[model samples]
Target: MATFSSKTFNSALYLSFRPGYNADFYKMLYDYHMRNNGQFDTAVDVGTGTGQVACVLAEKFKHVHGVDASAIMLASAVQKPNIKYHVSNGEDLNMIPSSSVDVLTVAQALHWFDHPRLFSEVKRVLKPHGTFAAVGYSFVMLENHPRASKRVYCLGNEPDQLGTFWDNGRLIVQNLYRSIEVPLKNVERHYFPDESGSELPLMMENVTMNHFRNHIKTWSSYKNYSEKHPDRPDIVDKTVDAILEEENLKEEDEVTLIWPTVLILAENNA
Candidate 1:
């Protein structure tokens, strides 16, 4: 697993800028196990950055334990009943009891883990046939505008400062985890479902440019660029400005963004 520098990862800005996984995403996770007649009482959210996925699991599971490597990131996680946050590496989940977890989830952070060791730990903690999901989302896309959308896509995709700052883990996500080997059996991609367990139309609308800019600024690559090129501190500002000018948009102008999420679902089969 790659070690993240607290200096590079700004937990405060990350909590503020990163989009939260919606209820639909949680519903799919909860139902994945239940639909298979597996238990749904306890869940362990590995690499539970800011406790987003763990908090969601708390609604369905009797207990939800969130474990992360960074203390700074865990500090930003919200406190809630039925939810506990712990500082631990994904590969070593010795704090959790064996065959005790009903569901194990790693949201947006699986790419950073030592997959084989993490899978072994997950299997140790999960009951037979327990669900394991690794969730990731594609680059944020802007709707209702072509020029601005293309520019944002280019910023994330093309070899620029942001591109150079991205770590190897990012490549796995960009490939939708296709290249990464999964040690678990019967793994497949799962989609988000509404509260009723039906597919929900994935959509977002009326997002302010400020909010969009904030999301871009939260990218690890962008943050890394900011740290290395402190002298070129205006890159973020200048980038956002260019988008606004090119799109003839005001700061408050509402734009639509679509973040297509992918999930790698598997069963413990213990």
Candidate 2:
């Protein structure tokens, strides 16, 4: 299936609802780059929806480039003075000079790309030893609410539920330790769950019915469903109501939501 990550329907919904990356996550990226002796001389964020991550890149580089297929998204990103924005799909990197980018990253928008095409272009644009990374994040509904298990399918089928984007980073360390050599050095720092199981601490959020309703607008499923079923009454509201009624979630209630992110980094494999 095609993806909704471009600036139009996907981006409109994303900017309206998607949460920004956490400082912890941001620090990890910086630390990785620094550890690897990588510098952000020139950076690009592909599929720069609403420019959220691009804004962060601006702080590191002399100037950052944000590119997307959607002009609307580029326009939004253009508002950043140090961040140049372009409306070019990743499949065609002709606009970007070869070996010009030091760090190339994609956030929450990787699955939408034609990966073979994108990977090839990334190799072309990145200088030797340059790092390419992709990171994604997702809501932890089950972590957010114990009762959310009943709605696992809803969460799984989300248009943007790419890469099971929910890991605590520490868990990644654990898995790597199990599989590969520890303290695995050598050109290091160059690399690198849809389930809500029992008794996990809630990634809680302050939520009332209205607050939850507002969040509905942030959901692509809710947005698409609304467009298809405008006369069908508000299914999102009904879903929220059902959850609230069943869980007895009151105005003062906060529910835990799970959010996991997967970060992948590799030297250009050309």
Per-prediction TM-score to the true structure, in the order listed: 0.90, 0.73
Runs of candidate 2 with Cα error greater than 4 angstroms are 1-13, 142-144, 155-212, 250-253
Candidate 1 residue spans exceeding 4 A from truth: 1-4, 191-206
The TM-score leader among the candidates is: 1
- lDDT for residue 36 in candidate 1, whole number 0-100: 70
Q: Highest lDDT: which candidate?
A: 1
Model 2 per-residue lDDT tens digits across residues 1-270: 122442335555456555566565566667766666777788988988678888888888887888887775554453667887887887777878998888888876665566678877888888766777666544445344666544543543444431232222323332322222211123232222324433222123444445555555565555555555578866656566777777777645665444444555566543
Model 2 lDDT-worst window of ten: 176-185
Q: What clash pairs does model 2 have?
A: 140-258, 143-256, 144-256, 144-257, 165-260, 166-260, 167-260, 167-261, 203-257
How many clashes (backbone atoms < 3 Å, residues ≥3 apart in a chain or on different chains) does model 2 have?
A: 9
How high is the CA lDDT of each candidate model? 0.78, 0.60
